[model samples]
Target chain A: MEEWLRGLRGMILESLARHGLPFPVGRDVCTGWAEGLGLARGGRRILYTSCMYQLYPYVKSVTGLLESLGVHRGGLRARMAARGGSLARFLARPSGRDVERSKAILRSIVSLLRRGGVEVGYLYEEEPYSGALLYELGLEDDFARHAGMVVEALAGRGVEEVVTVDPHTHHVLTRVYPNYVEVPFKVRSWLELAKPTHANRRVKVAVHDSCLYARFLGMYHAYRGLLDAVGIERVEDPYVTGKDTSMCCGGPIEAVAPDLSRSVAELRLRRLSALSRTIVVVCPICLANLSRAAVDVEVLDLAEVLG
Target chain B: MSWAEAFQRASENAIPRTGMVLEAYRYVVSWARELRKVKEEVIRDLDRYVEEAMSSLRAVGAKPYLARGAEEAREIVGDIVGKGKLVVMSKSMTAAEVGLRQHLEGLGNEVWETDLGELLIQLAGDQPSHIIAPALHMTREDVARLLRERLGADVPDDADHATLASVAARFLRDKFLRADVGITGANALAADSGALVVVENEGNARLTMTLPRVHIAIVGMEKIVPTFQHAVMQAAVQAAYAGLFPPTYMSITAGPSSTSDIERKRVSPAQGPGELHVVLLDNGRSRAARDKELWEALLCVRCGRCAFHCPTYMAAGPRFGAAPYAGPVGVMWAAVTRGVEGAGNASLLCLHSGGCREVCPMDIDIPRIIQRVKSRYVGRLLRTG
Candidate 1:
């Protein structure tokens, strides 16, 4: 194994050690607020963050780990490819207003579900990653072990259902988790959980479908359903949208081969930015990566638009 | 060329064609299930079907041979079609797999690739980029340049395709008549009836199969189906996936064209070829078919839609394939037929988008297949190192 990939793996394992997570525990402050709300936990829904939005705060650590291992940086694309593997994409740390924006979106989702007469609770810092990276990178044995631990943890909470914020997590929990071990709890994308409430924001938005959500979860129309309910005008790239042909956000492999990821992101954003200045992204990784790559476009979480 | 650059170049030609195929595939959505069942049955019991096909073809006076691997298949082809003869070939991905064209040419036969795309690729001294449209990576400008220099045929630098095709057609038609042998790869072979089915849009396959004195079909062992009806249905799957309702022509060869109409006597030298030989090439397929999941790839009808819809394949084109195979199924095919390293490397090109599965008529679950292959290959490499 390459020295850097091994080192990056060590760093991820360290995350699990320090915070019972696979990413840097960069202060999940929203979980504290959710805990204080004392929302009924036994009431059918457990709000799961997938730790992606929290990982947003620590994503640079993977790159920092890469440079520390002497993997030289170049341009954005070349530098990404220099990292040698996909271990780094675990962090899609949101920045600026996006952090506060991301937290607000999560808070709004809980409130929206609450308004709809549903109960929501958090595992706080105890939430583990859905082990999506391990599964995706072909570390199935590791993922299987991790998934067992996760199922045990979630099950111990007496959790009846899971409200996942990210598509990768939603897919792993819904689709992948069952194959390894029994997932007794029902997993739903937060988009499925949150009913629309007026944000008083009336602007055109392009819907950038999460490949995991739209293609894997068969949620192509589900987002449109959510968007439609929000009473917002949403635009879709005709060629790249729909159930069969939705384009990827290029965030999945950002750490494995940065250049390829960049090129994919550039092409996708170029096409998307042509349609609308503000695009509604479905996953935090999608929001982080696309907003980073956007030239003159605003990338927002779907919940952010609704909130 | 770099894989990314190649895909960018090829997609200009591929994307529109894929759009058309996706549209056509919607109409035949029902066939995918039927074809999947047929592929499962035929592939799971492939060896038994091969034996049945061998017996059935032999009974009809057509010689059949089961080759263990690529070398044996190439040697069999070599022995049958000897030196100092002109050979014309139809478009065949299997032929590409064993390097048949290069092997035949090395054996002193003047082989004229008859398919228009194959002919252009042959003239250009380039590798075939697509299963059906072999020269899809080449622009008209590239084709014109190659024709002008290699074929020495007068074609303008910016001349459109039709004119360039006509010049090549005139040159190839003469070779077609004089060729001593013709060769093709079967889309599917009917084990029960001893029939060889070849589907193509061009008229080349029909002429190649019938015109020569000796006709040879080099087919993968897995192409065997239980019945003629099954073979035709598989052909429909292939055509539909290629974005065609059906090819312009379908040629079903039932032994050599023999006639008993003349005075109650069946002639030895029939209307078609006096000699008909079917080479069932295993070429690691027997080993692959034993693999519980990898074998599903052998049941693939080579629709090209999986590759067509793949984002990596769209970005990388033929470069996305390892050997003769490309795209998602290509990764599996390459891993089994070629070697693990290239296939493992090519596997990374895929984004795990699941777009191919959505379009796959068979619902092959290609992401899982690629991942499995990658896991095995990486394990082997680490152990060896």
Candidate 2:
């Protein structure tokens, strides 16, 4: 490991330990999205966002600021940047519009589940970050500790089934967490749980599959099924949207290599835009990263598109 | 060309070819599954297979030597070829693994890479950028310039692909005619029949081995399978998954050419190479096989499909891994051949997209292996720092 990535991992573990999140953002940002959704709290089944959807806007701002300031190359500057916690809190804050958009997408997911007769609750502040970044970054020890805390938090809330909203969160809960800890909850993606009535809009859109959802989690068909039920005609190319060949938004490398991440996202956006002006994504990371690169095309969440 | 520019060109040209392979042979998926099982069976007891293969080769009059590591393998080969011999080589990643070509050249031997892509890479004084297409990073324009500059072959600055190939062909035909030793990497070595299988698109490998009086094959221990049928299956599966299905040619050589044509009695040096030598290189492969999850990497057939599908690989070109080995599978190979530290921080470049595992014919869990490497790398960093 290089000094920069090592320093970044150190800083992230500290943040996760101190603030219960990867950033210094408070619990309000994690639970604020469910304000008027009228969902129950402390129930057996809850909609677990894993703070991915809420934190993505902040991720966008922070990665942009770090990239522009040339903090990607680690040393004194990067270590200094990581230690400037207060400044990060200010810079990591999402805009008012971005906050509302995040809330709106979550609200749409709840509504779709409700319409499909699948009533779900919200964990609010009790929901823990899935510790996906910890696992993905290869901090297995830290991830194991964090996953233990998350499982404890969910169990305290009497949560037995977690309906996840994004691919990264859904994947950690469904596949990765159990290996590190005793996961007591049943993990399900909203794509599998939601069955909203046909919209009959008959609109054509390009779908950007989440690498986790499409390949690792076996949810590719489920996502396409959601689009079909909503009456959206998917315009796909074998190279662009092939089940095996779909491109990534490069979210996984954003923290370590921002410039390369942006270039990859731009490339993916270009291929997707050629298929349709409206590009739909199933993961929050994809939505954030792709939305950053989207100029002429409209990048929307599958939840937003479904609503 | 820069890494980014090369990535763009390679992806533009490579993606469609893979798509065509996938569409043309839907049976490739089932074939890959069968190959995976066979590879798993062989890797389960690699040492046993090595002993079986060595004895079988000896029985067929082909000398087989198992070199414990890279230095030993290089030394053995150096002693065999001696100094001032002419050696022409077919494209072999295993040869690149032990740095054979440079070693032979270092010993005052004339060495030429017969594969067109490798020949270009050799002429350019560059390392191979891809496993199958060694000079994939170079465009036709780059090839024209290299031929014009290094070989001083008469070629237009804007020569087409065929013209560039012909110039290389005419240049290499002479080397093939006069070469004393032909060296190659085996695709699969059969322990049951003492056969060496090679899958190729061009006829260069066939000529390289047959025309020379001395033939030496450098093989990795992992290329061994139990039977001749398994070896052939391995070749077909590798070719199909590599998007070069029904590979234009496949050569299965069991031993040095001999004939009982004269009064039903065998005679040596009948045709082809009078002597065949097999050098099996371990070089940390057996050590790698002992690892819990990393042992899965030994089953890889080097299809190179994983590189085309990996975003970081497409963006960084050869920068993603050590030379000759690049992309996701390259990370594993580098970690094996070159220690964990030698693999560098390139493991950080993996996105954990899980795309490589999906495309892998061997069903190796590359993402898990990469995570393990990252974990180990970080652990080493934490301890040493």
Candidate 3:
């Protein structure tokens, strides 16, 4: 497990330094996708960024690396958590395919912001990883150093304000970064930015707030405000759905213990399953973990179902 | 073994109980803020409060004993109660720390846990999974099975909660009457009037503290409040946090039962215990007092609400708790009193949801405390693993 994590960490760090990309995002997938926006190098006034913005392909790269180490999808946690080896589960960890879906989510949010009359610019290939995983893993030194590097990269690109795609990135850049490093950029989750001008979608979705967004960031209301304006029908489950009462998606423990992560996710999924057939989420981490756990239900990103 | 099964059962019980507590918080304006202020003041001057409590209780003809640690605490209790005396005790985390029941039983004294949950777990030979609701891990069927084996009773496999309680009560009522000594844990120790205030929904604590010829109330030194009014307020907040409406029974036991009704003569022995012994156990609390960051942990009223709301605890039950203490608060208590290793991997399971901290009446910042415990392990092991 240690060797696997170490190798994964090295791969991510190497990709960030060499490619000038925070995540191991797919080069081919992002190339044509980047053409419409026509991303420029200098974005001084407003820069819409995300720590895990390139999450879909980055997750894919992680899965590929793990497979190379003889740990395939579904088999990843089994080999590591093979005590009784009775339980079987889907791999909810971020993968390259998840990065593709994440890209779509980001694209919709960017488009929504554009329609909201905000001229948002992207710092393509310049944005660095926010070291959220490092902080969560209790690697304070690495996190502090990585935070400084990320801040430096953003500052070097002359970016002042950051509109984040997901709460994990939003939380890290805004809250965690200032704790250790000097963060000069103004930050907000894109949900906090995008105006709900589009007509009602008329869809019923059960919203699951990831721990960071709901509790720490206090952005649960922001999502609700958007959903309400978008005219989506919200099916509230008093048992499992609410502001602080909602359960965690268990994505954070994926690095430490995948089986435990699966257990946590499964527990949360059961509560959510009773609520709605379609579960909508704001955080990419939540989308990945809950989507994998939703065997009998469909999980949608907030962006996927929104304006 | 089944995290989902336990999570479902525990949450089903916890959700409504939590609502009651939240409503209490809502009605009692600034409950958390006011309590935090009072608790902070009391905990900072814990030594003075401890001294004041001892001096005042002593004046009331109750002998107050101080023990440095768990070993000393057990020895002190043993000395007072003596050998071959029936001892009936309520659920007290302080007593559990030193394995008091086992120590007394080793010396040939019969010790019975009077609290229903504690009694069930005791019969089953199990440690408490939750501090407030100790037998939370055991289902009704499990309790029935344990009772049948332990007490040779006609307990059916599918006995209802009322039936189970009746059996436990019938068994404990005799012990309460026959016992020579009654022991309890105080929620708060008021220094001004030297009152040991313990609040409980079950009548067991009241029975355990009052019925016997001798009463020994054991509490951590951190339980002390400044005055009677402060004790009253503390009880209110503690009850609200514990999902009770200021508790069904609030036992404010100042000293041995006294009577001045006979021509103002101040005769000591009344209906209650003739002799009273208040054991204020330090047991690493002073060390916690000196530490700046860890000091607020001592302010915990042990309401057990934090555990109920905690996801890891809900899923895993006892697996999420430290020994002698359960849930997020338990993690802190076990770390401070016992050490970091006892907290073990359970502290790491905390997802930093901040749910526990939000509902915490004292507002102890439990997730951060868990992080601190995790850091200690990380520092020692040189890895997050």
Candidate 1 chain B worst ten-residue window by lDDT: B376-385
Give candidate 1's error at residue B74 in angstroms.
1.3
Candidate number 1, chain A TM-score: 0.84
Cα lDDT of model 2 by residue, B33-109, tens digit: 88788778777888898999999999899999999988899999998899999999999999988899999999999
Per-residue error at B134 for model 3, in Å?
A: 0.6
Q: Number of backbone collisions per candidate, in order?
A: 3, 0, 8
Chain B TM for prediction 3: 0.95
Please provide, for model 3 over B1-385, each residue's C-alpha lDDT reduced to its tens digit, 9 standing for 90 to 100.
2546755777677767767667656854375577678778877887887888899988888899999899998899998888989999998988887788888888889999999998887787888887788877787888788889999879899899999899999999999989999999888888888888888887999998888989998888888887787777777777776667757999888889989998999987899999999889988788888877678898888888787667776665676767668788888888778767777466666677777876787778887788767656544544654
Comparing 2 and 3 on DockQ, the stronger one: 2
Q: Evaluated on chain B only, what are the TM-scores of all the candidate structures, in order?
A: 0.93, 0.97, 0.95
User: What are the per-residue Cα lDDT tens digits for candidate 2 across A94-173?
Assistant: 77777788888888898889888988988778678889988877777888888899999998878889899998888888
**Measured by TM-score, how close is model 2 to the native structure?**
0.96
Inter-residue clash pairs, candidate 3: A56-A98, A56-A99, A57-A99, A59-A94, A59-A95, A59-A96, A60-A95, A60-A96
Measured by TM-score, how close is model 1 to the native structure? 0.89
Model 1 alpha-carbon miss at residue B260, Å = 2.8
DockQ score of each predicted structure, in the order shown: 0.35, 0.59, 0.40
